[model samples]
Target: MTNYNELTVPEATLIQKQLRDNIKVTPYNGPLNYIAGADISFNKFSTTVYAGIVVLEFPSLKPVGYSLVKKEVLFPYVPGFLAFREVPALMDAWTQLPVKPDILVVDGHGIAHPRRMGIATHFGVLTQQPTIGSAKKKLFGNYEEPGPEKGNYSPLTDRQGELLGYALRSKNKVKPIFVSPGHLVDVPGSLDILLRCIKGYRLPEPTRLAHNAVNQFRLNEISEGWTSLL
Candidate 1:
């Protein structure tokens, strides 16, 4: 992976804008062989990235192959620049997979960013894969509350009156998850996949598994007395 830190502000900003402008918002109507999620856990010194791929029997969400990868973090964590710190380890983990996933679900913002290029956007552009961004919290944008029921969602718009994505209620009465197109997928298509993946949970199954996988590594590191470098 190349160091994005080497790029000047103008260069990076231009690159980000180009990506956002050229994004494909087409509906994702492809085969769903596998659904994967990527997440990261970091101590002060090392960061472990875990990507879990579940090969579901088309339309039936079931796990088949699962793998993980952990590596030391090379970049420091900076707000709005998390992709630089996290994508290296993530790409390492992703490339290690023997069975590539059909759709990737990321745990961060997509177009809902100051630069309109969040971690999900960066990963999708770099890999040219079908990806979606689902966040636990809002990064930027304004939206009305979704209906007090599952499957209800509303558009999340930016300051310039552009639709970024949707704030969706995955589970009844639970907190809504922010959904956005990372790449080949559109906002509606991303939300559809998320809803299909939800089995009465706040998070989709693939993402929940990935989150647990990464947190497990974090727990093990903490128990081993590894000094935090974050």
Candidate 2:
């Protein structure tokens, strides 16, 4: 793994371009038994980052295992460089998870970025897992807004007309979310998994659960006055 904080902005951008060449969009061929979601939150006025992971049984979407880790934020927020800021802590949280998932769903982009090295793709490479990105908003690519009905989707494509992701409507009459393959997963597989994971919500269960868990952990830390200079 690259030492994200050690690299300057220009170096990081170059690394992303190189990493994009390594991304594989093959579909996951193994049994879809377990799926995981990952998210991160920050403590107020501090560089403290709280990362959370939730593993759920496939189809049922019932939470079977979860983990959280708090660590000093290592990278500053930069557009198109979110993985550098959040992935290290998420890796810590992933280590604490009791059950390893067959597939991971992240709360960010996959190939739907300028260089196609979104947080989900970055994590997938390091973990060597089939992963998908289900982001609340589009970060790159051009697409028509998906229809309001549930499951409606429009292909998100780059200027060259290569598919990058999809504008997916996870719920009826609600705004669409962006779905993209991270690694070892194809675009169709990504959308299928996300739709199955949806439970009357705009976000899929895995990411929704992870988002809730990380925010709760951050709230607890703040309330308990946990602080470090870092």
TM-score of each: 0.84, 0.92
The best candidate in terms of lDDT: 2
**What does candidate 1's lDDT look like per residue over 3-121, in tens digits?**
66466555656767776776666788888877877777656554444433333333566655445566655455666767776777678767766667799888897777787788888
Candidate 2 on 13-34: residue-level lDDT in tens?
A: 9988877778999977899998
CA lDDT of each candidate? 0.74, 0.86
Assess candidate 2 and give its lDDT: 0.86
**What clash count does candidate 1 reach?**
4
The parts of candidate 2 lying over 4 Å away from their true place are: 221-230
Best by TM-score: 2
**Per-candidate clash tally:** 4, 0
